[model samples]
Target: MSDNLAINGGPKAITLKQEEALRWPILTEEDEQAVLSVMRRNETSLSEEPMKLEKEFAEYLGADYALAEINGTAALYAALFVLGIGPGDEVISPSYTYWASAMPAATLGAKVIFCEVYPDSLDLDVEDFKKKITPKTKAVIPVHLWGVPCEMDEIINIARNNNIAVIEDACHAHGAEYKGRKTGTLGDFGIFSFQASKNLPGGEGGMLITNNRDHLYKATTLGHYRRAAGLPEEYSKYQHTCLGFKHRMSPLHAAITRVQLKTLDEKNSIRKNNIEKLLKAIEELPGFHIYWPPPHINRVYYENDVVYRGEETGIPIERLIETLKAEGAIVRRDRYPLLHQQPYFIERGSNPEDLPVTREINEHVMALPTFPGDDGRLVEQYIGAFIKAARTF
Candidate 1:
């Protein structure tokens, strides 16, 4: 058979250039022009470009107000501050997410309680989240991990019952929807990062969107002090020394993000189609569980990943990865380090064993190239590599 296993010194399964296939934030001359326009205006530091981005972003998401920030971390911090999450407050977040989702709470002197995620969706487990709430619990952050929207309705109901704020860490989910509503707009406060690697690449920027007027004003005062003069009388006095941090988004970043936003849905559709095509090809293989969002959810792909059930295949996950790599497949273990097990949180009394489901899910997860560019050839090669690797074992 021509399909000899590559691990046995046979010709590799993947022969095409994988770099071009996986290149992200597909830049163009238009992006350059937008940045150049900002530079020509000499408005890089503080300009109307950021405010323009805020309006356009809010409109795109149907949010009542939006505030631009330096980055996703700063936006999260402002969200925590405006929600009154302070010393002694408890914030619940899933352990299977980026650090920015939960670390901001610790900075606000709040106790960051890590929760478990569902093995199937890799999203926040509502049951575990419910169990973690207490009198000190003041907020809950449900991250849309890998562009998969969390169970927002359930989380919102629980938050309402508990009288806690809901902040959606939508950094990974740009243009994703749950039950016909956008991911970021589903929570009390939603934040999106426009970093170079994000779905909407803007070099570096973030946006906080909300329907709450007070929350919007407070977030602005927390980071965008320059806008304080236009705020209500009570907040106008703090124009010169607004809060303690300057989290303003650079005009250049904002300009680039605006251009990216224009084509976000179009680009997201391409990513979704490519991922679906790849998933459909390999989903039938045993021991490999491909993740698909629920019928009501429209997910975008920031990074493609799959769960490997070693027990079903009678092969170790590490060995499987090694075999796939030998076939020229770009595969690796999931990169997110469990936040609960990190040193800073461990010192705060977070036990690694507390979230058994999250740990188990992380152990079996494998990251794959997102294949942002349309490359059916590479996709087919990857599919063949997976089949060849499985048969080899």
Candidate 2:
């Protein structure tokens, strides 16, 4: 019976049992009413919704100012533009993050230096980050990958000593905290995503947050035209100043996001609980390990990831992933091709060198689902399937 490794054409582990999708944008009647109230007031486009969202988010994060944008990428771009990072400057970022994180800097004609990430946490490698800093280093964008906060204290100190701006690519980490402070507020600028898959789901939206009033003002004007015009004694209405773009967040998206904010803490708590339960269930399994953040750090897992020691288990990582999938577990190899090694970067003349640990970890990692509202039964089933598959393999 134990020889029934699913990848070997043997009988599967558990019969598939899929539950309802209750992950992102878990809307209630309250969410609907918020949107309806905006429309009913005939304040559809340039309404109070986005303003209120910015205010609420600012208050939530204890930030001095916040500006809503069309998406996280736009928020990041606005930050880069406002900080004057363009043309011949270099911005160091992790190679394991989404393209949007570093692409905006490159799009602005800045050289993007990809750095290696810590194998276990998948966060920025502090040693590599220091080595990448040069005279032309204008900014450093550290991503909180998979909702795990980066080493903010070290990164902040490094950026300050080098006189470089720190822009946190916190799209994946909404409620994550490092050393008792939220992720977005840790750096000079922090950007969040409200895409459907993000922790804060508004279909598509984003917010840029900062403690500096001047930086906020510049970012606000770039994306928020009407609101910026209303500031006291700045300028008359309908007078456009400062080359800006149409990156405003629509009222509808803002309304949904406001409602989402009300329950984000509660939702994150549930996700944390579910992840804890799942971890405990799989703790005794051999060659299986989950990355745990520092004691002072509080993380919200966007995707629960686990690493397997294939050498110890005498099994290939890919084979283990297939077996897990056959057992009705929503598991997949967590592979993000090293950015410097990609064809796009190769075409742009990026030299790919030794990042042995990063490449090895990426090849051996797999992610499991740990959305909010997970029940005990589901956790038990997932663990049972995982154990069955692992032992068989």
Give lDDT tens digits, candidate 2, residues 78-177.
9999889888899998878889998899889998988889988999999999999999999999999989999999999999999999999989998899
TM-score, every prediction: 0.98, 0.93
Error of 1 at 86 (Å): 0.9
Clashing pairs in 1: none
Which 10-residue window of candidate 2 scores lowest in summed lDDT?
Answer: 230-239
lDDT (Cα atoms) of all candidates against the true structure: 0.89, 0.83
**lDDT for each residue of candidate 1 in 1-393, tens digit (9 for 90 to 100):** 347777778889888888877887788999899899889988878689988999998898988988999999999999999988899999999888988899899999999999989998899999999999999999999999999999999999999999999999999998999999998999999999999999999999999989999898888887777888899978778889998899989899999899999999998887777777778877888888987777999899888888988889888889999888988998999957999999999999999788888988899998888878855778888888888888854
